[model samples]
Target: MRSAPRTEHVVQEAYVMSRDYIRYVTGRAAKAAPTVTAAALRHAGDDLLAKYPIFFKRWPRVFKAISSDNACDYLFNILDQHFQPDKPWQKKELTWSGILSIYVLAGQLAIHCQSHGMECVLEELEVRVGEYMEAKVCPGIREKGGWSGFVERYAEKEEPERAAVRACCGVLLLLASISLTYYMYRRLR
Candidate 1:
C-alpha cells in the first residue's frame, strides 16, 4: 500500500542566487555579472586545492570515480563529511572559504573527469551544487551580506574571475601527485 503524498516546503529566497550560481559556473551567464563568474569559482577551487594538497591525496579512489553516475552522491558525502551542520535540524554555518571550497571541490571533480577523458558532468554538478548551496549554504551566506560580501572578502583587489584563469592549478598538481596513487592502485592488482 502506498502512503499519502508528502509535500515539501520549498524556499524561494535563494532562488536568484542559486540560479546565478548555476548559470555562471555552467557558462550560461549571458550578461556575466562581475561578482562571481566561472573564473572566480575556479580560482577559489585552485586555492582550496593548493591549501590542502594532502586532503585531495586522501581521496584518490573517490576522485577517480567521481565522474560515474553516482557522482552527486559522492559529492554530497564529501560535503557532509567536511561541512557538517552544528545540529541535524540546523543549517550549516560556513565561512566564506568553506562555501567557496564546495564549488572548488565540484570543480576538481570536473577536472578529474576531464583529465581522464570522461564525459562532462557539469549539468549534474550544477544541480547538486545548487541544491547543496540553497539548502545548506544560502542562509549563512545571506547572513554574511550575500554574494556582494563574497566579492568584498575575496575579490577586493581584483575581479573574482581573475582567479578562474588559475583555476584547477591544485587539481592538476594533485592529479599528477596521484601518479603515485595510481601506481599504488595498479600495484594492488
Candidate 2:
C-alpha cells in the first residue's frame, strides 16, 4: 500500500542553528519595532536556511516570524560568486545566464517555502538581490574597474529578482496545477 502523505511536523535536517541562536534572535527582537523584529528574524531565518536549507523546514516559527524581505538571501552568495568582478562572465549588461540564475534561486526558494505552506513576496526577492548588489557587486565594481562602470550604469535597473520570482511562481503554479489534476484523474480513474 502507498504511504499516506505526511501532514505532521517533520524533524528538520541537521544544521548549526543551536537553541542559543534562537534565544539570541528572540532576545534581540524583544524591544525592536515590529518591522525591525521581523527583519531581524527574517535575516536570521534566511541565514539559517542558507546555512542549513534542509534543516530550516522544521522550524515553523521562523517562517511565521520573518519579514517580507527574506525571499532568498541564500542565493545571494552564489550570485555574488558568479558576477564578481573577476569572474569570466561578461561584464556588460546583465546576461541571460545571470537572469536564469535568479530564476533558479527564486524557484528553489518557492519550492522550499511552498512545500511548507509558506509564501514570500516578489519584493522580498527583489530586495535581497538589490542588497546583495549594493553590498557586494557595487563595492567590488568600484574597487576594481569592471566592464566600464557596470554597477553605476545599471543602478536604476536593479537586480532582475522580481522577474525571477515571478517566473518561479508561474512554474510552481503550473507544477501544482498539473499535480492536482493528475491526482484527481488518478483518483477518478
Task: Work out the TM-score per prediction.
Answer: 0.56, 0.27
Each model's lDDT: 0.60, 0.42
Give the per-residue lDDT of model 2 (tens digit) for 128-157. Answer: 444444443343433444323322332233
Pairs with steric clashes in candidate 1 = 39-164
Which 10 consecutive residues of model 2 have the lowest summed lDDT?
8-17
Global lDDT of model 1:
0.60
Q: Residue 90 error for model 1, in Å?
A: 6.9
Q: Per-residue lDDT for 20-127 in model 1, tens only?
A: 444544455556543343345545555666788888776556676555677778888988888876779976567877877776666556556545655456566666
